[model samples]
Target: MKRLVALLFALALAGATQAQDGPAAEAEAAARMLEEATRALDDASAARDRVKALTQTVRAYEAGLQAMREGLRRAAVRQQALERDLAAREEEIAQLLGVLQSMSHTPAPVTMLHPTGPVGAARSGMILADVTPGLNARVVKLRAKLDDLVVLRALQDSAANRLEDGLRGAQAARAALSQAIADRTDLPRRFTEDPVKTALLIASTESLDGFASGLSQIAADPTGAPGPAAELAKGSLPLPVQGRLLRGAGEADAAGIKRPGILVAAPPRALVTAPAAATLRYRGPLLDYGDVAILEPRSGLLIVLAGMETTFGETGEVLPAGSPVGLMGGLEPDDDGIVPARLQDPGSDWTQTLYIEVRQDNTPVDPAQWFRTDKDD
Candidate 1:
């Protein structure tokens, strides 16, 4: 019973030192990123080149919010695991507590007495002595579990405010980026777009390959082709948007339709950027692939990004690498100010799909070959 009381005291101090590990560190990292993003937003407000400043601000907000969401997710998972473990040991814990209470209340002389006489009493004492260590070990395990739960609860509570602020900041940054892109005109143009030729190409072409093949004819200036091929970036392009791969190239969908592109599941309004310096050859509704941005990195290499709610940049404009291209589409959270679903249920808010297709020499190629697909996030 004295041991049990000491174990209870130890449980109170269990997480004090342990809280600096894993989930707590994640929360701290998220806090730093959010703080940095706030400062970026402030700087963007007064920046001479608002487009570049806002682009960085939006990316910072995205990174910060992603970290904060991941921390909350880890905390949620840890809390659930702890709860399940405790629930599974409920009966054993109750019995242990009962035994401790009985020992605490019972008189020593009475406990020493046995119905089977002195021999039985001596044997019972020896058994208890041996079992004490095992019981102590169980108490230590329970203490550790309780400690983890306490820390997780505290982390969750503290993260709620930060998460909300991050989400709001991210939204504001995206809106600003969109407006900045709209008001910008400093980007160099490879050639002016021929709208009539573009319309004819769209009207005449039946497939992505055909449209890509006809893209060169739509440039108003026949001599003004995209600068140089991004040959060095062939196998090392970054994903235009942050997402998880849903399906690889040519994978059949539920409707048995197979396309020559990879599908990426992204959260709503995720920023999509140019993976390499490219000329915006075409942008708008094309075929049945929703809003699309077609980039010509060089003469024959075409990068197609489809299924965004809104597209940015003008056709014929030479966009630098990492330039904002568009945003993935999905429903916003309800007006009650609840956090995004991903915070409550990790990975659940990836409701929008971005389709990426890389074509070289007017032929569809696996996007995975060009972009690093080994990373999970």
Candidate 2:
């Protein structure tokens, strides 16, 4: 029985250690990612391609923040499971303790003896042999649960500091990237924008279709040549931002209003980029669609991204594939590093939605047919 107990105890310890390591390892890896992002930010200042470097820094921070959130979520779930297990096993734990205590205090000779006779003693011994193993198994599970609770609780406490650092780093990287984009003047210009014509076009149009049909009116004339055609990129272009599909094309919202575009639910302050080399046909507020970016990748192919808080690049500039376009808006984190309310609540925090539409020859097409949406972001 002692040997069995010892073996069970060892197994329980191992199990508890493994359980504790899972979330702890995830948190550590996330911290490393945040650290790498910080390094990237430092490197951006001296990089020949400041926009690219800052972009990488911003993306790194996003990845780290995501990982950290996932780690905390896992830890919280594990803690809850441990708490439930402990609560459910309260009676079993008490019984196990009582039995072990009673066995410990009883003299060995007394435990072996039976009140009736040698036969009764033999039977009692056999019964004890059968029950002892089960009791030890229960004891092992209880010990493991207790250990896991302690480790997970401690992990949560330590994680707060790491999470705060990562949040601050992410904010700094975003600000730097925004500045880098604004200061950029190296991108080629496809055409010069006629602001008066663009304004007239917006004032005369009430829908995206109407506005798209009149896009050419805003451009003075073609100057720089267009980039390589995006025909081969069909059905394989990455989404402009890292997010999940909130609504498919032509899906109606709660208000029963339907648009021929897809809505992508992204985290707050997420970066939006150009999925292909394209000209910045027009960017800014239009009607009730919020800030918009219209990209012309080919003569008749137009990609429109709307609902961002900010947009980058002047109209008619040729943007390379994966260039920063804008950022999704959200409430800022509180002072002292408390996570933003949006981030604290993951279920509803995808408050920022990027509206994406692909138009061919002045008609809206299903964005999914152009952008790949099968993989997790």
Best by TM-score: 2
Clashes of 1: 0
RMSD of each: 3.6, 3.3
Candidate 1 lDDT, 2-113, residue by residue in tens: 6655575566346645773787689889889998988898889899988778888877877777677777677777778889989998998888677677677777678879
Candidate 1 lDDT = 0.80
Model number with the top lDDT: 1
Across 98-210, the per-residue lDDT of candidate 2 in tens digits comes to: 66555666766787778898999999879988987786767666677778777777766777777778778878888888888889888878778877888889889989888
State the displacement of the C-alpha of residue 183, model 2, in Å, after optimal TM-score superposition: 1.6
- How good is model 2 by TM-score? 0.88
lDDT of all predictions, in order shown?
0.80, 0.80
